[model samples]
Target chain A: MGVGPSTKETSLHHFRDPLVDIVGSDSGIDLMGVLVFGSPEGNEEKIRCSRTAAVVAECCRPDGVIVETDGWGNLDVDYVNCVNEIGERGIPVAGLNWSGTAGTFVVDSPYLDNVVDFNKNPEGIESNIVGENNYTADDVRECVKRLKIAMLKKGMNK
Target chain B: MGVQEIDLRRLVIKSFHMTDVQMGDENKITMDGKLTIDGSYVKDLAERHSKVIEKIDIQIIQPGDHDRYTNTIMDIIPISTKVLGKCGEGITHTVTGVYVMPTGVDVDGEQAHEFGSSEGNLKDMLYLNRAGTPSDTDIIISFDITFKKGMGQERHAIIEAYHAVDEWIQVYREQMKKFNGNKATEKHEYHDVIRPGQKKVLIIKEMIAHGAMLDTWIFPNEPSGVAGGKSLIDYGCMPVMLTPNEFRDGAIHSMN
Candidate 1:
């Protein structure tokens, strides 16, 4: 059977922690709220954020839990309060800083910068972020190969 | 690699539909059908269908443009034995014409022409007629076509095509309704305006054609760099080219 949308989103969300680790703690990672833009059908913005969120979650496993609102107006204020409530227990509640519609929320560690820039330079991190550059076909092939190896390792570990 | 010669016989047309729903005081639904066929059809169908068939011509017109140039046509001569076995030996017959197009084209004319005294083999053209039951000595001919925009943009082109086909079909149906008398007018009107009997079959065929193009062309494949600059890569391999701010500004402009 085809995967439902929610399951797909969850699976995608699970993939981001590794990259988050590369960024290091001093950079201050902020989990953004849901990124919603464009016609719902086009989904260009949603896909970008979802992919970024998933990758960050994979890279930062155990360090942070990125929260994405289900949609605009669907955010649970009580849930935000609950995360804040947990912060009172001394747990770190990082809010992913996504832009567009659902950009506002409260969090323990808030990364004020927009999440969009990270999607562009997902690999590089530091005081200096590289400008946009087109990838050669070779670059893409290598990335795919790396992703495949990472996926295989993940499956074997599981 | 040079242009690859795909086995035409292996190709088939697949058909499907896209539905859009609108909510209001009363819900409204519209369904657009699609057709997909392999690129090989460009050569194979053109060859096979051309045999025993006379010719077909296609023209593209932009919106507000009155003139049209012939796009392409196929002519074919069929092997008689195939027709005898497939369509039966003793049937009134003539060459049947079939044309398929994406939803972008507005087909205006559908007619048949017979070569003088040439005993055209019917088998080759049998597929052209949906019924395949034509009386012997009768030139069984029809034209099926679609008019739609090229897969990308050309909104005006699609509108023009739709208007042209609509006008033509309307005229044909009216003539049929007149011939069948007033009693058949209502039924004929419904069939003609709402769903044209003859055009419906062609529309289905066009949907298959459109689907094939979408699958092969629109759907991204391994993102191989065109030209000699790069090798094969997966589709959507690149990051989103636009920044969020740029995108947001563009969205604001569109709304305005």
Candidate 2:
């Protein structure tokens, strides 16, 4: 759930605050906390390259983990690597999809076991995009909420 | 220490749009979106008052350059200026399409950053579709600097490194002051109207005050700006308050 310097959440905007803070609070479980990877503006891959995985593994050590990328493209590499590293710690992993292109959303990420796609839902809607008629912050909140539930179910093994 | 209301006008940032960039005989941005820079002119500026710098090299990187990378990034600066009074005051002009990033390493390839080092290909490192993500249509200027040996972690050495890069950015800060407000693509107005019944909120953002690589600056001349900014570490990482307008107007600058 950590953001990089590339996104306004990590740099300029405070959009991620309520969205991430909702994770442990909204569930009424007090079960999760989003870690800000805080990789520099460029060189986000360093999170995977560094021993940060060990740090994250030691920190969360959760029953499951949910990884969401606020922005699209190259950051997917960082998100997927982060999930892979967390999964290697013997944890089940789920992902929140931000990609809407033709191919390879969560499927592209090798380590993500389950994915929640708000856009794919017939009832689905936009979440965190900007411009004309972009998704509302409510849509993102719902999406993350769904991801937490999906990760919980995945951890339960049906 | 207590509540203070600084005029919101200080944070009014005026901006200019740059469509493209290139290297040429002089440092200038054209009306048709051409940014020309004589690299030597910038190198000369960096060499001054910084005994730690061995050499400075400038490179032009476009949206999709292949196999290109920069190590030890220090700052990502939006070229802008204060049209009147001090920084964070009056009219601040900014160039929207161009950004400057400074990079450096010690003589033995030691990075200038302390804790985490960002060293990788430029393309993969960047995140697109975000607020700060420069468009693929934007121009990037990489000021790659190499420093004297054993100075990578010295507080004064890092400050001098920032000084050298900031000197290079000063070139654009001066040029942007000439832009008229009519030519601006957009204007945003901010006001602090006291609503008697609304929920008053205060958010205390604890920024990094660690010296050397991990440091955050306050009230830079521009947003995420480096030049003429104060280090939080020097201030003992004390709690500082900023109004919403001040926060939006580039008052907090993070560097490594």
Candidate 3:
């Protein structure tokens, strides 16, 4: 929540993209492109980013969607909006974040229930430890697990 | 006759791998994969930034030696230089198996330019062998800078520190330019290609240039270097168009 360095610099080098390994191991799951979004500067920018992300995910035409954000607080406004926008389009979207009890979304939708909190800290709070609450392979697997159920529910709804 | 397309710009990057690093009489790369650096030149390097910098300590941290406590990390810079031609269209010599990390703190024991300082044991604070970090086998050249008591928060203080490190590395860059390209440990060639009657693709990369530590350097004379590069803030954070070959050649130096 209170990182000194830019997220662009810290996030890229501090963690391995688990998506690479997951795609290599599972043939049924064809990995799509990754969409990146930073903390928008203003409310307009936030809404724009959320809509753009949803539009991009729609273009990908996947069976399910997993949206991950490396931030909390005000950033969750766009995070939850992105999920809701995709969900409103009938896409089964799941959110990945470091929701350490206190890291709740500022604006949320019904789709927020499918969120996977990847907090590894014992205290379930933001710490100075770099990469402590980052998304891992286990978290990605859990998101996939929940996403499959959401997709099944959507199929039943249709 | 149909006009044939030719690749006008080609970049060749020659890499040399150094397995071991040590402080010695002079800076030189041996045939046995050992990089010997002259520690005596650090005093002269510190002299370049005497106003804001108090002292500069140059040390080589070997692989798996991450238990040692250190100051806040500023940046991890790759050692690369242009051996022939310009940045994107010519020959570049680079060092693999090693990276230069800059760490800093003020005289009053405050971490420099960091809001949430990562000042604990290195292993516990950093993820090793990531895209921008040192690999498991790579040695780390730690350039620890000590700023003046009240200068840690100033943007120029960190810039001077980086300039000192750049000057120190220029010594090695000059020597690397003279190495034989045939003996390079790795070689990669890239071309800037253009195709007509095809869909256009553009990659929009967003960078932070909100002033202070949130700045980025673009189009340095050397690959991934600070010299001759313009800061994104200096450009008013405008959209700068760059070729793919230029980008792949290390055009963007993230100061953040």
Candidate 4:
């Protein structure tokens, strides 16, 4: 889904796999996901995605949420909207980020509620490389786990 | 094409639920349903398609295994045997919980996927909902097929590379043909039935019918089969109506 590799682009990428990996690796959590595409204004796809996620999030009433995007050019639109839309729901989100580093580190994304680095341990999160892929499956699992904890702490503090 | 009555006979598919997959001295499916792959079988298959495959590395990824993933995936095929007749009209015995797949790059690191190459850690890159990478319930017979450096992007080279590994499944296809259906855990049947009073429905599926990596295979003598199947793209993207049972019984498969 890119518009013929031209000036226009859509967020129909395969980040769902890694997102699935993050949630799927942890045995405790059930990963229900939907890939959202959009236009600048009112697109049916965007409305459906927003509404569907809100409904699921309300129904599941999960501990917390972790959101990330490809963060290159127009891709940031979906990421920002997902975080803010979910955050606007009064649910805490610890956004996972990838930056220029070997290990995980917290970076500034659009949503600042809670941000966790994919490659760095950050401050409170304890993570390490467990595979030839540099970071292990445990890395993804730990990041999500730490995000949930961080969100829980924020919820209590608020 | 005129209005013709397509008679599709018994398209019964059997599934032997695979329990565990291992690479050891023997290359056979045990009575206990464990898949033991002999290293020599891969060598022989590679030799047969020696023109395409420079090196063949066989690896089996089981559920709950950490730090295990595949290289770039080319195709996911189910092991099946044509018991009665040819594809689209036969009793085909197959396994459910296991998949035969090809992964990896050429001798030099190049993208094998024609459109997009998701080559990274297998655990991270593999999406569970897709074929071959089912949740903890299934096992993957991943063949790391590496081609020569320059042969990576060539269409013919890519097809040959895929056919090289498809030969492995062909062996299972032949062997499974002799399988006793009574031992099957499940059986599915397809037929071209007529409903005289009811309105008929014909569903047309436009699939990957090109020389690229994005391709869909239909009625290849097996479910998601490749070896002897015809490419839809080669058929000039023609229209073919299939019975619902044929679709349910594994007449269509994908490689995207």
Best by lDDT: 3
Ten-residue region with minimum lDDT total, candidate 1 chain A: A3-12
Model 3 lDDT tens row, A15-108: 1245333432343343342444444436676667666767776775666777765556666776777788888988887667767766766676
Ranking by lDDT: 3, 2, 4, 1
lDDT of each: 0.20, 0.53, 0.67, 0.51
Best by DockQ: 3
Clashing pairs in 4: A103-A119, A103-A120, A104-A119, A104-A120, A105-A120, B69-B122, B209-B233
Compose the digit string of candidate 4's lDDT tens values, residues A64-133.
6655432222223334455566667766665554332332322223455465444322341211111112
Task: Give the runs in model 4 whose Cα sits over 4 Å from its true position.
Answer: A1-158, B1-9, B129-133, B195-199, B253-255
lDDT of 2 by residue, B121-183 (tens): 666555433444446777778888787887877878777777776666677667767767777
2 versus 3: better TM-score goes to:
3
Between candidates 2 and 4, the DockQ winner: 2
- Residue-by-residue lDDT tens digits, candidate 3, B122-216: 87776665555677788889898898987777888777777788888788888888888888899978666543322122222334443445556
Chain A TM-scores in order:
0.26, 0.57, 0.86, 0.50
Q: RMSD per prediction, one decimal?
A: 25.8, 12.1, 7.0, 14.0
The C-alpha local distance difference test score for the whole of candidate 1 amounts to 0.20
TM of chain B, each: 0.20, 0.87, 0.93, 0.84
Instruction: Name the 10 consecutive residues with the lowest summed lDDT in model 3 chain A.
Output: A6-15
**DockQ (model 4, Cα):** 0.02
lDDT at residue A107 of model 1 (Cα atoms): 36
Q: Count the backbone clashes (under 3 Å) in each candidate.
A: 63, 11, 0, 7
DockQ of each: 0.01, 0.04, 0.12, 0.02
